[model samples]
Target: MTKPLIIGVSGASGLIYAVHALKYLLAADYTIELVASRATYMVWQAEENIRMPAEPDQQELFWRDKAGVKTSGILNCHRWGDAGDNIASGSFRTLGMVIIPCSMSTVGKIAAGLSSDLLERAADVQIKEGKPLVVVPRETPFSLIHLRNLTTLAEAGVKIVPAIPAWYHHPKTIEDLVDFVVARALDTLDIDCIPLERWKSS
Candidate 1:
């Protein structure tokens, strides 16, 4: 059986990135092991006007509905509530992991080897196991402290991808922008899913 790809959603503003990425990954038929931080639920309600249920089953239903993925597609997903889940261990092999909209606080925690939650612990496992770990931070006007922490992660072999969309694609809508970032993340994971148009010099 193909190992699943771990997708962690941290507390960040760009919940759409995670939603779109989930859809694309499911469409590509990759089994997903998903975990969301508590803050992710709050931000999803505030930013996307979508409320996620606290229960794992309800949260799975919520994600499937929001991503417009069919029931079978969602069947390929395995949801975990706590950081101590199986994926948090280095022994659990996976294709890789991506933490979309990774909050700066989460970044700092991962950088310092602090696995306070499943998201952070899973990321830590990826790093220690020498697997592809892509972190997409959706913050603007990064402070020096943020830069330093990001650099630390980079030095430790983490792919720090910020959610900065390029206008070169001439994005006409918000979804386009979200696709740009998600596409970059897929690229980093060595996944062949392209959610947006690639830049080609004319």
Candidate 2:
């Protein structure tokens, strides 16, 4: 049973991507170790008019155990500093790790090998374990500093995917754009999904 870790950061914009990805992964029957940053919860409240899981005990928001059946078991949210957690080690096999809407600060920290929190730590573990690590950064008007940080991680084999949705998809709604990027990230992780169409030189 292959699983993936989905980390949501407060970097800015696009919580929908995390939600959609989590939904799809669960629907696909993959277990997920989840992490949501403090700022991410705040952003969810301000922008999306939603609340973050209050504590690790709020696992019901993600985990669903109905009539002793594990339906919708994709996400298992834990405290960011829980280094003693199961997903903290490479021995716990997983398909990959993704940081959706990854913040520049977090990106720099991970690039520089600083794992101060569980999300960063899990990402570091993924890299060290030689597993796929995809970072979804939603910043625009890129600075040299951002590019350098992205490049640094890229050189180390991390997939630094900027959350720039393709216009070629003819998106009808914001959700369409979000799904397009998430689908691309899943593709990088080699997860089979139905997403956007590729640009062709016609």
Candidate 3:
């Protein structure tokens, strides 16, 4: 069986990026191991007006019934709440991991090697295992601290994909902008899903 891709959603403003990533990955028929921080749920509710249940089972039900039911591919989702989950260990192989809309705090914690939760621990495992680790941070007017921390992660082989959308595609909708960032994240993972128009020479 192909190893699953781990998707970690932290508390960030752009929850739609995470949503788009999940949808595209499912369409690509990649098994997903998903984990979201409590703050992520809160941000989702505040920004997207969607409430994600805290329990792992209920979270899966919510995604299956509401968020991802339309897709034909198997979700193959396994949700985990604790940091001690198997994916947190380097022994558990994965296709790699992406933290969509990664919060500044999440970036800092992961950069400092502080694995207080499953999201952080899983990312730590990815970095230590020499696997692909993409972090999509969604912050504006970044401070030096944020830049330094991000630089640290980059030096350690982490792909820092900020949630900055480009207008060269002449995006017509919010979803287009969201997909631009998601496409970049997918590209980092070597996932073959193009949700946006690639820049071409005129």
Candidate 4:
């Protein structure tokens, strides 16, 4: 079974994107190595209206109940310095990596080759190893700094997927829009999915 390394940071504003991605990936039987930023924990409270759980079991339960994600034990959380972790090195053999809601700080770090944390280290390994690295940045009103860093990462072969939801799908709810971007990201990883919409070429 081919498992992709999935990383979620707080920088993604539309938390639903990560949740939906998690749901689909797990359902597809792909084992994921997930890491959440400190800020991501706070954002779930401030934006998505979901509170952080005290225990790892509670965390898994919260995600399962709230986002319909499937996982056994503490599949959703990993320590920052757990370099002992499997996803930390290129030798671990992962198909790809995705950093949903990647922050400008993280983007710049990855672009410049900074691996202070496991998340950063994992991203570096992806780039150095020439594997697919997808970054879903949720910020809007792009600053020139953000654009340049993104372009740099893109040039380095990272898929800088901005969190811009497609309107052509005529989304009735927020979930529809979220699924659209998530499906697109999954597509980059070559994961077969019933994409949120079918394109009609004229």
RMSD of each: 1.8, 3.5, 1.8, 2.4
Q: Which stretches of candidate 3 lie over 4 Å from their true place?
A: 65-71, 74-81
TM-score quality measure for candidate 4? 0.88
Worst 10 residues of 4 by lDDT: 67-76
Clashes of 3: 0
Every candidate's lDDT = 0.84, 0.76, 0.84, 0.74
What's the candidate order when arranged by decreasing lDDT?
Answer: 1, 3, 2, 4
TM-score of each: 0.93, 0.87, 0.92, 0.88
lDDT score for residue 57 of model 2: 61
Q: Write the per-residue lDDT of candidate 3 for residues 105-145, one digit (tens) a residue.
A: 99999999998888899999999999999999989889999
Q: Against the correct fold, how does model 1 do in TM-score?
A: 0.93
> Per-residue lDDT for 193 in model 4?
56
Q: Please name the candidate that would achieve the greatest TM-score relative to the true structure.
A: 1
Q: Which candidate, 1 or 2, would have the higher TM-score against the true structure?
A: 1
Cα lDDT tens digits for candidate 4, 1-202: 5555655554456777777777776666666677766677778878967777645466666666665655532255666556567677778787788888788888888888887777888888888988888999877788999899999998998887787778887899988888888878777887765456657666
Candidate 4 stretches with Cα past 4 Å from truth are: 54-58, 70-76
Query: Could you give me the TM-score of model 3 versus the true structure?
Result: 0.92
Evaluated against the true structure, the overall lDDT of model 2 is: 0.76
How many pairs of residues in model 2 come into backbone collision? 0
Per-residue lDDT of 19-71 in model 2, one digit per residue for the tens? Answer: 77776777777777777666776777788686767587675453332112246
Residue lDDT tens for model 1, 133-166 = 9999988889999999999999999998899889
Error of 2 at 100 (Å): 0.3
